[model samples]
Target: MSYKILAVNPGSTSTKIAVYEDEKELFSESIVHSDEELKKYQKVTDEFDMRKETILNSMNKHGVKEKDLSAVVGRGGQLVNIHAGGYLVTQDMKEKLVDASTIEHASNLGALIADAIAAPLGIPSYIYDAVGSDEMKDIAKITGMPEIVRESFCHVLNSKAMARKVAAKAGKSYQEMNFIVAHLGGGISVSAHERGRIVDAIPSDGGPFSPERSGSIPLNYIVDMCYSGKYCKREMTKKITGMGGIKAYLGTSSCLEVEKMIEAGNTQAKEIFEAEAYQIAKGIGELSPVLKGKIDAIILTGGVAHSKMLTDWITDYVSFIAPVVVMPGENELESLAAGALRILKGEEQADPYKK
Candidate 1:
């Protein structure tokens, strides 16, 4: 009854592939694409063949037989809003991913590469917990401005996976537990999971500033800065995301480096690091009301969650809401495989991709 699965996760500069037999990982490989190499492609989708080839070669090197794989699961990409779950990789989904007008992201290549490899083998290819999955209530979308509506754009894959993991550890099903998962990484996403669905979330843009993102900023200040002619649209966008937060404050983005600076008695670094932790705690607090104070556990995950200094600071601030369980690392590949396995084992049904 064991099933072999191949999970593909494409990031901005790397393609991570893994093979799992049931719940056990056989091998995992991360294929790094340098800036010079990636610059040859005008669009992210254009690198499909190259990425797919590299993945196949890695699998071959790892002694994985293509025909033996029961299913191929990929990290979901930017598409129209959909629910959080596994979806069969269909032609319609591929079309949406390649649409030129939509945002270009490296993740869009996941399904394409997966389908290319799985289709000839006559096996199903699926995308689990896609980036565009939105399960928020309509009320949560409201904003003070009529033109702007909040959208659910948190780290859906990792957050939901951690929620399920915590639920399992507590001897409960994910559908029977309520949890708030804070994914603290380069960007931070604090999500409120009610029952089995993510009811609401503080997406990286709307939540606390992280190591590389500005998160929520004063609108008036942003407007003034935009009109002030000191920067252009692209520069402003980078400031709000890539070049903001800790890097903007102290000239580096590595949490480890920041912690070292604090140990070296750098007052400014310590203050900025504490502020990041404070904002994360505030974001977690904001989602508590969304779950009605009935949260079973507050899970801390993602790369930055590995930092004891940061986690301890956050735990000290929000321990009253619920017990904080720090489960670090992204673990995206395993999550993708598990999602597909649930569907394959008939424990959960795979959702269809609409639009």
Candidate 2:
């Protein structure tokens, strides 16, 4: 049986919507929201209705009716940690998405909006490979300091999707392959895929620096900076996750712009760009032990993977672990669509979202 599935992914500045018939995508649209436009909303959740309306407008423009949909799947938001795969949105899930105590992210709006759209039609709303998916082994959670334990908060959606893609290309089951996946975009996430499970990962905020994120800085200096009081709490947070890394050094987040400057003989741009790639390779190498040095493949993906110069720098460092497979761009929309189709086709079961 064929199913019309709508996949919605909410980013920091855009809502990406896609309609699919099983594995085939019918239409996709990225509804971008400028900073100036989003400033009106006090919180990310406040834009729920606005984003939903935008999605409806796009769907209407594309001639896709709500009643025609079989299932709606969204990018999992800031829910509690759970295993990988599709989850049916229940009342519990909705409450958690809107909980004030939990972290607020644009993706959290995905399930809320999906539920609203699917409820009236009595169709199921599901979330797949949410940002909060946690599957690390117990030992992996331990940090040198007992007070702070490591959390699994990397690009689980894109990393797992690319892992499955490369595994298929190699004629091997994802559950049987040991792979290292580096998702380098505005942020970077390097993880080890032990078979189908992600055993360990260096999340964007805690790993190598990216185009805009200041991955891991020295602990003592960070503490000293915090005490120095040059920045407030919010500004300090932004420094680590949003305005740091190459953006801090070059004053722009676009890798292409940085590359252009590098081509024009900008020594600072050239060195900073190479340093980002070097750090990415270092993060990938750190995961070698997680897979016991028997990695089947090293997969490079996400937006920055499109840069041959950057990917080459990373490949040069980690090619010894396994064959480097470059799978540029994020496949999150397809992954969400496939997860819904899997449940609809009885190939996979949708798990309940428990608080």
Candidate 3:
């Protein structure tokens, strides 16, 4: 049986839309939104109509009719923490998507766009592997201080997808293996997948420094900086996640540019690049104990995983823990479609988001 699914993924500056018939993709497009164009909206939620119109236009241009769609799936945004799986979009979920306090990301627009298009046709809208999906164990929640607790806000959609892929390649079920999957991208997330459940995660904003995010910083120094009056709260927040990492040190977030500089004998560039690998390896080491060092495989994925130079550095340090698997780039759009298809085929059950 064939099912037609539309997957919508909104990013910081672009919206990715794809149409899939069962497992095969009919067509996909990434609509780029310029910084200046996005500047017109005060919040990411404000651009909902603009993004929805763009998606409809793209679908019309591609001859994708609403009547042919079996369902519309979207990239999950931050909501109340729930299990990892496809969720039927509800009115409560839509409300949380537009709540800035819940999550202030372009991805929040994903469900809104999907619902607007799907609702008129009476087709169900769903979201799979939401970023806020939390499966962390109780012990992993404590953070030494009573006031703060760790959140499982990593790249759940991509990390979990890679885990299943690697498990399949190993001729084993994901439920039968323990693995540490690192999603190295614009923002980095390293997580421990125990058996089939993600028991721990080093969220992108708090884990190893990535292309643009600062990762973990010295607590005392950050406190001092907050009181220093040199930067406001908004600026400070941007500094930690956007203007941090290599962008903060060498003034560029492009890993390819850093590699070019390293090839030209730029010692500072090479050192900082290696430093990032070092931090990533350290994160892997930290999570090894979470699985009691019984990790089956260490999978590396995402756009940054395309760089062998960086991957090599990370591999050299963590190879002893487990064999490394490098799966480059993200398959989020296809993953979303596949997830929705699974529910359609009764291969997997869709989980509900309880308000």
Candidate 4:
């Protein structure tokens, strides 16, 4: 029997679908959704229905239908302490699917799409390496109050990229070595991988902020800002992400734009830009102890990791502990697809999907 695996990713304005047959990609398309139609959705949960319908319609245009799918996989939303791996779809994952408090990530609908369409075709719906999947152990969950770990983190897509780049150079599989991979992307996440499993991590909560994320901040600063009446708590809280970090100061998120000013000899731009990269480097440095110098490589992966100046700076400073391997850009889609194969082959166990 020919098993067709469908990978769906929901973006804010579009839903991307990739059909794969085992390791081979058959077709890929991005279905665009208009903002006006999306705005009509009273709840974020409606996006699941909207996107499902959109994908169904798009598949029809190509003469395919929901029944053709054998296995459905997709990007998942954030959930606490989820271990990375393929997971069997269940009702538990569905509840969080509709929860709109964390993020309205279009990718969240991947699992839902799989859920709705897979049964009719006798296919299983699965989530591949979702953002919620945290391979980190209990120790990494610290945020403060002995219970809280004042830390930050990125995601699997970023860490795996770094791990692969470094592992190849190290002449070993990423699974064979213990490493601390820090993903400096829209949001930063660092993980301590013991052999193959992530044993610890610094979550973005109460940790350092990033260019797109206010990584972590002390409550006192937040309380002070609130009591001082200079900033609104609700507004400031939002500022810790979307408008915080580089966007807060520069009104732009593109590192390319910042580097242009640096090249033109803008001192202030140079300082702030350099400082941001430095903070990421500094974050990587903190993870050194977690690996206890047994760290094989310092893997930098993300859109930001491509910065020549930033990579060089990290290499210069972090070289003493381990060599740096930089894998710029994100191949999250491919990674997600690959993970599904791992699960199907029984190479990895099916984990419980959060959302």
Ranking 3 against 4 by TM-score, winner:
3
**Candidate 2 residue lDDT tens string, 188-300:** 99899897998898999888999989999989989998999698989999999789999999999999999899999999999999999889999998989988899999999
Q: In model 3, what is the error at residue 77, expressed in angstroms?
A: 0.6
**Candidate 4 — which residues are off by over 4 angstroms?**
1-3, 27-35, 57-68, 99-105, 146-153, 161-171, 205-208, 351-355
lDDT of 2 at 254: 92
Ranking by lDDT: 1, 2, 3, 4
List, residue by residue over 1-355, the lDDT tens digit for candidate 4. Answer: 4556777777778787877777687767878888888898876567777788777777777776677666777776555456666787788888776665656666667777778878677777788666666666556666448765532235775576457557767788878887777676667776777787666666554344566677667678877888887777778877886788777877777888888878998887777777766766677778778777798777777778888887787678778877777778766656666677667777778766534
- Evaluated against the true structure, the overall lDDT of model 4 is 0.71
Alpha carbon deviation, residue 122, candidate 3 (Å): 1.9
Model 3: lDDT equals 0.91
Kindly give the stretch of ten consecutive residues in candidate 1 with the minimal lDDT sum.
Answer: 346-355
TM-score, one value per model? 0.98, 0.98, 0.97, 0.86
Highest lDDT among the candidates is held by which one?
A: 1
Candidate 1 residue runs with Cα over 4 Å from true position? none
- TM-score ranking from best candidate downward: 1, 2, 3, 4
